[model samples]
Target: MITGASSGIGRVAAMQLAERGWDVAVVGRNPGRTRDVAAAVSGTAFVADYNSLAEVRALATALLERYPRIDVLANNAGGLVGRRGRSVDGHEQTLQHNHLAPFLLTNLLLPRLVASDARVVNTASLANRGGTIRLDNLDGTGRAYLGGFPAYCNAKLATVLFTRELAKRSPVTAYSFHPGFVSTSFGHNSAFVRWGLSLLASRQISAEQGAQPLVQLASVDSLGAASGTYFDGLYPNGATARRAQDDNLAAQLWDTTARLVGLTDG
Candidate 1:
């Protein structure tokens, strides 16, 4: 199952996996585009907007009902919100959309994931290098809130931390990766983000190129690395921000996240 599969790397990856004879589930926010992608790939379509935790919960329930054994789950449906805002669930929008929403969905489906021995691929970014995960301030507001890309960076860092904690606590394998800056409409809402990416235009890669890492990680039989490893493309890279490497921080973040999202049993 791939969220954000209506466009960009997610769309390309969904197509590629379908061609490889995998039954892809294209999850997207836009109904029309999602249906188109699903039709193109001969896959299923599930719609959910990550801004709302209610929607994320519904998506999980739907997914659990549809797929008996999910092989791969790509939590790829997030972007850089231009300004500091609150989601319907009352989190910093970036924190909710990029981290909390996926966190909730994945945990909700944890039983199935463990049973199927599924691999989880989180599409994080090199911007994670700029992130600092403060368990006290995930909302990206007040003194800690540096809006725009910093918020995105922090959320991506949370993604990596989530992956690590998940592996530590579960039987399923989980991986997070930097997909190399890809040209996509991901940050179209943020003019600053667009300008920043434009400055690096020469270094940008295509969506297809970016999707290769996700494809490889999802399809490969053996990664030859631990479940919590983060990758730069297909290669394992341990050079994350200091906070991202902190197992104590990761565990704290996991517990905090569970409480924030109302996951009492976690």
Candidate 2:
């Protein structure tokens, strides 16, 4: 299953995976766009707003009921909300959309994933280097102000830690990756960031280029053994940093996230 599969890196990944004979489930917020994408790949499309937990739960239930044997789950449905926004559940939008939604959906779908010995790929970012995991500030409400970049980094960092902890408890192999700042509509909602990113166009790669590593990781047999690792592009040679490797911290973050998302037992 690929979230955010309607455009950008997600779209590229979906197309490549389809060409390689993988039957994909494309999940996106826009029904029309997702239908277009799914039609292009001969796959199915699911529409759900990740910013809302109720919507995510309903989508998860539908997906589980429809596809009983999922071989791979790409948690790629995440982005920065333009301003400091709140979700329908009163949680920070970035935290809800990027981290908690994926976490809940992955946990809910673990049975299918493990039954197929699935490989899970999470789309983290290099911006995570600047993130600090503060259990007290998990919701970003305690902070005086929240910016798009910082909130995004924090959420992606949470993804890495969550993947690591999940690998520890479950039989599923998981990984998080940095796609190398691709040219996408990622920052389109923020004019300032868009302008700044445009200035760095020479350093950025195309969405297809960025999706290559994720596709390789998802489809390669060798990567099945390398669980709970962080990747820069296609390389998975090193750990994410001492703090990110802390299993205890990861557990704490997981608990906090569960509470925030109202998934007490997840």
Query: Runs in model 1 with CA error above 4 Å?
Result: 144-147
RMSD of 2: 1.8
TM-score of each: 0.97, 0.95
**Residue 173, model 1, lDDT:** 93
Model 2 agreement with the true structure over 124-239: per-residue lDDT tens digits: 98777767788988777756433477788788889889988888889998988998879888877866668768788889999989999889888988864468888889888444
Error of 2 at 44 (Å): 0.6
Best by lDDT: 1
Model 1 weakest 10-residue run by lDDT: 139-148
Note each model's CA RMSD in angstroms: 1.4, 1.8
Number of the predicted model whose TM-score against the real structure is largest: 1
Q: What would you estimate as the lDDT of candidate 1? A: 0.91
